[model samples]
Target: MRTLTSSTTRRRLAPLLVTFSACAVLSGAMTPAAFADDARSHEWYLDAMQADSMWKVSSGQGVTVAVVDSGVDPSAPELQGQLVPGEDLNDGKAGETEDRTGHGTEMAALIAGTGAGGGIQGLAPRAKILPLRYNVKAPSMDTAPRGIRYAVDHGARIINMSFGIELPGEIPGLREAIDYADRKGVLMFASSGNAGDKDNVITAPASMAGVVAVGAVDKSLTVTKWSNHGSELALAAPGDDIPMRCANGEGYCSSGGTSQATALASASAALVWSAHPGWTGNQVLRALIETAGRPTEGKVPSEYVGYGFVRPRMVLLEHQGDPGAANVYPLPNGPASASSSPAPSKAGQAVSSAPQHGEAEAAAGSGNTTLWVLLGLGAAVVVGGVAAFVVRRRSA
Candidate 1:
């Protein structure tokens, strides 16, 4: 029997990817990068992430990320040859080439948008993006499996899904598809949603084992109140007030979203993968997780930021991370090891004042991981297929 609950769809799917979707994520407006020339200074997070130094080691030249969101406009000046043919799960025009909602376009830019036409610069400028366009209105049964299968069947090394749904149903096919990708040595990332201050719940497919659940944080390294927190969280990245192209894929918006965070996380993986071409997805992911900036020591993951903020430069330059078992999963079956929490830092990230939703003190083995059950919705029970739930909703 399949489990039934919400939080199965991608994170930005309900809020940004789907047409006619409801979004309550507060729009903190910022100065949009009008052109690529006007925008280099606008992406302040890149410097915080030390993108330049990391680029000296690896530019992610040979990696391809399958962006499974809205359609993408591959012809965008910044994306010229960086995008390859993908699949269309929804409308036809955007089938792996053009983007409609612009959300997908921005995500593509974040992953590999070159600083061309005075547009936003990507974390991995040489990496390629594969578009996997799907409609929010499509039946869940048909959507999840097909999109995932197509991306894996193709040559996608990393899959980025910044959208999701919060329902009371578990599509086994979706789980199987994720398993297939992992088995094939693909690294998957999805937004943890922007709802941590309220009902900080675990969202899928991030909640699923083997997939990396990414949350949001500002350049200050402080975990934002909006990003959801749970044991599902694998790591955190810059999500608050980022600069990127608007949804139409034409203009720019300085205020980016959690979807951007997921994309950046994916790009980080690509950078590491490109630098170490011989490593498997498991090895690459282990490097990111183990080398991430964390205040707590040992194996325990933070509920809010997981292993803490992603520091690809640490992996590329310092070479401080370990590539554990090539095929073994990293998450602890029981409790992960722990240590005392470190104080907050002046730059970048530090330990938060309070523990993430279910984590414990920094002391050795002091944390507890919790998995919340999905309760029922009122009259409108999502029956046949699941739809992406808005991030602003009370429960997801």
Candidate 2:
């Protein structure tokens, strides 16, 4: 279970503000303090999503997400004891948890931070992180797709890829890894790109079919001017003015990008999955698309904010949030129900672990179609070895 948060772009970096007791202060609702100390403050979106309220029901306790990025610092206060053993794919280092540039550490905290010593709070505080490092920085010509495949083979239920590369064309190996993950029931989320206001191009992994492509938005809920817009987009989240552990790992500051949004979205999915133990990846994703927020004109799921903002509460609150046809896989090229008969069960009922909500529920788009999918959801009927390729070009 993992999901993305959205953010907007600003000329200057915003100061990190402590969002203690924000749910109570903003919504007049009682919620616990994810981080009660003074030194570490997470991005405001955590409180905005009522994370504490959601945590009481399910803190993503049963989910494991593989973070494929520069590297994850396993010693961060918030990440102490959360990182599982992983291998380095760079071929330059054996430890995937050793973060050289600290970007991965920030992403890790945003996904599953424990909020130890006021550290940056995670959207899914109970979820476990499996650090898988790759070269996403300067002077790098490493094939990160190898790392992605390895993570999938491992026990990671979800893959979090925050870095985006605009390769001239899709690499066969990378596509295989992605397709493999999809077949394995592993949900993959990636950043669209940071150069949104300019090229706004669809980056690798994020643009691929069967992948959940995320974009950034601001506190005002408007899509960031820098966020890429077009098909291949699935959902949006809080990406701007996000507070994260600094590069030095000593303090915190506000950062903005589709990267942070991707992490948060992964965490959100984790929460939903942890709550609904019996649901499949399609059901979890369907709930996300079904419950997202939208505007007055009956929710415009634009290329900019695909399916609107990600809101898991709507799914968690419902007893039956569109599990859809269980036997039929959700992806387009994936497997179809071999037998159409209703899934034989003890009772003619569908069970979900999502939390129970009071009369009030989060805003779900008005559209009749509660799911988002331009790609197939069924299990991959075809799996083949992809030819290896030399790293022709690389960037930081």
Candidate 3:
């Protein structure tokens, strides 16, 4: 059993220093008083992704996403009525709402926060959260796998795993749990990892088959330097300088990581799933991949950005993308293809054995430049109600 740890990296903001009342912190009661007045202003991706327009179509009303992390603070203002009954895989003593590291609560808020009392506004504001707590430091590997099974057996349709382990091979129990979830029509998303500039090793369960491995990109749509990359990387999302509720129950903090990217990807799926309530997990994932922003110059499934940045607006607002066959899983190593090829079970094996497309980093840079130009053109069209073309002339 591999020990799981949070994939998020938080940076305290000196300028945004509003703390909850001492009494509230001591009494273990989360209050709205800790939220900063200008917190929402920093949620740049909401506007960039045109969440308001998407919200008009679906707020993920009926979907329940299981957040398997440290824990969740159900009392948080944004999560007041959003959580369902949850379990603590660590020990039955502290329930799922006791958020030890604050990471779980942050992830939950990102997926379904209602923005009450100036709190974070979730992408899928109406969705419900089922918090499943796993002890990060516990030596037992059973916690994560048990949590995954618990979510699948419960009413969860999507599971957001914002934590990861950089292991050389797959843990049988963990892999089996993920496979089980897939069989039950549950879509799983995990942070690829945050060691892009460092070790850059693939992490599990992200590299595992049947899971959507998410990487991070900035407001410019450029893949962040710290987001892990590999053949298993399935998608990218805005993850840089993201704002979230602080763990200390103080004001919000600005942070960035693949963890945030994974949450957004899961939330994006919820939005699509809620709109098309009858769609299977395969169909929903198909829609997401088919509509994702792709590179102009390189073959898709790029190691850096995968199918490209996740743009649910294309599915929700524009009515784009084909939700292909319900029974057929979309990506590699899907259930549809599981029996044919050996499962890419080991992180090291998955990373080393997969065929390398061109230089991933180089491809990503060129593709992002094209994507930015396209986004700029799209913005111009929205403003002017006419198609705009930008031709970049090369110097002779």
Candidate 4:
């Protein structure tokens, strides 16, 4: 068996054991009292994304997002009554609510936390969380596939994978499981990786088709320097300078990375799905893509921010975005036919090089042109100009 290293920090593990490290990104400890006093203030993305306005329309009440990661602490104030019983693929003795690394808890909170007891408020406050635990330190190849299948079988509408493995190619059973989840109409989101400023190697499951590979953006709405970029990237969300529950459960901590971005994207999907319960996973994803914030200048699907930053507000509040054909997957590497099951292709590589029509038009100024056109109007003209400059600076 080949060994796998986490996309976050690279470390040696025992032979035959794969390491699926939690994409902790960047983290710093904070005391409980201090966190209670100032934690929510650090969540700048909530305000920037206009979460308050979106909440008035939908709180993701009926959606359940499965978090595949270290584990979640059900006892946390914000997570109370938010967790559905989940299975632990690791030892199975501790169950899924016990968090060893705290990363899972942070991701859970980011998706559905209720903001009680001064905790971090989730993007979809009323959504439920289903935690699926795997052995991060010494997992086998089957670990991720098992967790994914469990989430799909257990009524999880969306799956959030906040960890990644850097492999030269796809893992044996992982890709098939993702396709299975897709065929089942389950939407999956994974972190694009946090090594953007470094090696920036494409990390799997994220790069795999059928999974939405999410990158990171800061409070300025510009992609973060550490958020990995590639053809596989599908969307982006706020990740930098975010607040999260500390692993030790003492209080909160400031963290940043694509992992957080993935959580927010999942929550965004939950909100859209909750508002439109009859919408299929494909429709929900389509709405997100159609309403996403694209770069003012660049190819429609930029290697950095894929379709662009996720903006559920445009779909939820403004009633914008067209939910396209429910059965047809929207992305380039999506299933070939309308059957929902992915068309057969090479084992690991993505097949399609062309962008979707809507994506292309959106990029070419057919739709949403009024929203971002001002970005090209020069820095002194509009806020989007500043954003354009920042995006170019970081990507350069």
Best by TM-score: 3
User: How well does candidate 3 score on lDDT at residue 319?
Assistant: 84
- Give the residue spans of candidate 2 off by over 4 A: 1-42, 92-94, 138-142, 298-301, 318-320, 327-396
- Give me the overall lDDT of model 4: 0.72
lDDT of each: 0.64, 0.62, 0.74, 0.72
Q: What is the TM-score of each predicted model, taking all chains together?
A: 0.75, 0.74, 0.82, 0.81
lDDT tens readout by residue for model 2, 1-396: 112222222121223333333122112233333443243344557655767667878888989888888788877889998888877777754578778767788888889998887777888988999888776544243455777678878788888888776777776777777777767777888888766556667787787776788987544333555666666677777776666655554344446778888998999899999998787776677667655543323223445666556777666544434666644444333422121222112112211222222112122233343222111111111123111101011111
TM-score between model 3 and native? 0.82
RMSD of each: 11.8, 12.5, 9.4, 9.2
Candidate that beats the other on TM-score, 1 or 3, i.e. the better one = 3
Model 4, 71-159: lDDT tens digits are 99887788999999898988798789877777788889989999888887999999999999887788778889999999999999999
Q: Sorted on lDDT, highest at the top, how do the candidates line up? A: 3, 4, 1, 2
Off by over 4 Å in 4: 1-36, 335-389, 392-396
Ten residues in a row with the worst lDDT in model 2? 385-394
Worst 10 residues of 1 by lDDT: 371-380
Candidate closer to the true structure by lDDT (higher is better), 1 or 2: 1
Worst 10 residues of 4 by lDDT: 373-382
Highest lDDT against the true fold, candidate: 3
2 or 3, which is superior by TM-score?
Answer: 3
